[model samples]
Target: MKREPSLRERKKLATRAALSRAAWSLMVERGLDAATPEAIAAEVNVSPRTFRNYFASREEAILYSLAQTGPGLLDALRARPVEEPPWDSLTQVLPAFAAAFADQRHIIGSLLRVVDEDPSMRAQHLVTYERIDRQLAELIAERIGAEVRRDLTPRLLAAAAAAVLQTSIEMWARGDRDLALPDLVREGLVEVRAGLPAGAAVRVSSPSPAG
Candidate 1:
């Protein structure tokens, strides 16, 4: 039901995306100052004022590029049949989410520390993730009902799922360069979904203690 953007709008969006991508790549390669707004705009063949119209600063452009990780999730969830279990839909839809990270996994992994070191970037990163969490909660509620918002289930699942994604990325970013993020996410979500069912058949095993 959503209207598509006109060609002019699409061109604007593409330019904005290019500027953000340029800013992100430059900052990652040479640190933030190397990616000044004028420099970023120049990278994309745009004027500084044009860049300013899209983003207030170079930092905002970089963050905007970083936040692209989350956009497809809502659409993925919506594509599932209504009768499908939320957990099943989420788990199935998540593999595509993993694919989105493929091109930038290394870049994002390396910049994890850079983001941590910069207070503004760190603050923006947290805000971006938190906003996505709220958006996911809303989607889950819509899939079921608004009443689920009053109950803790939808919100809790959204939070836990977000945690799984964060943990997988952190693990990947830390050093496991070859680790498959989708597998980690699937395993973690399986555990969460299993834990929710009453009298759930699945159980974890522990070693017996020596006497």
Candidate 2:
């Protein structure tokens, strides 16, 4: 029942996928500085300008590579039975996303290292999450219908779910210790569903402190 992409659309998707894969592969093997945008485009037989058209920067390309799984996660979550609890639907589908990351953890670990060392790249990573937040909000809206705008529940649920899953994946990618990332992600989702810890306090970072 789904429509297949036309030739042109399929070609565009192929080019985008190639660029994303090339960016991650080169950056993982050679580090960010060596995997310049020009180099990545060359890998795909495209010009630097063409590369720029696909991605604003190397960081965006890297994040886009990882985000390949994001759409699948949303799709799976959306397909869950409507009678399922909202958080339950997310918890059920999130492990698949986590598993996708596990298959590519090597490049992801390298990407995380680059992000840690570059403020601008890290900012781009945050920006990428904003897109994810919006997409997840849309899915939440579909599940909850009217309450999505009338109340803040769906928005809050999306935020909480994002916080848990992202935090778990980031920690796992650090490679500081032995851990199963999918298991950790599942655990995080469970905890978020139950609410924050006994004494937890969230601090919002900003350019200036409130007087």
Candidate 3:
């Protein structure tokens, strides 16, 4: 069984999460240049050195909440009954994961735009998901009776799962408010499980030629 976090450990995690949120909020409100370690630390009532102890860079600090997404879901996946289909288990576990994004829903669009505008942030974002992808691959391999490194299936499944989560989040963050994030995630999972066939032709409107 996994060990429960001590009160001290919980406090440290809370501090780290606070720092990450402060960094992101500063970046959104004042731009990246304004979200310095000193500023972020000040927002969290911590010293700059304490911030450094938690995160190595401003980018890492800003993206810290993202780094926790996979592990929690992986734990849920592991606890699922062994007889459940791997794909079904993957799909069913997403609503719980989607709920974690509720706190960010308001600022998610700004967060996406900020990340898109900065190359370093964009790179760090990819790196975060890549790490999740690798860990998820290992879990999927165990579920499917495949080797993590040697079997391509596990890696592919992991990538697809990650893509579903990423795409769902992006769409929910930037698209209509009518569709809830969990519902969006469930829809994406359904499409992915159906092999993402291009079932219907998409209609497009094109600009008229300049006179």
TM-score of each: 0.83, 0.86, 0.85
Q: Which ten residues in a row have the lowest lDDT in candidate 2?
A: 195-204
Lowest summed lDDT window (length 10), candidate 3: 195-204
Question: Model 3, range 1-211, lDDT digits (tens) per residue?
Answer: 6799999999999999999999988998899999999999999999999999999999999888888877898999998998898888988898678978866776878878878898988989999999999999999898889999899998988898899888888888887545888888888888888867665446577999999
lDDT of 1 by residue, 1-211 (tens): 8999999999988988999889988988888779998999899988999999999777778888656656678888898999997878889987568757766677877678877788877777787788888888888888887655496878987888888788777777676645677777787688777784644767879989989
Clashes of each: 0, 0, 0
Candidate number that wins on TM-score, 1 or 2: 2
Mark the regions of model 2 whose C-alpha exceeds 4 Å error after superposition. Answer: 147-150, 198-211
TM-score of 1: 0.83
Question: Which regions of candidate 3 deviate over 4 angstroms?
Answer: 6-8, 176-178, 199-211
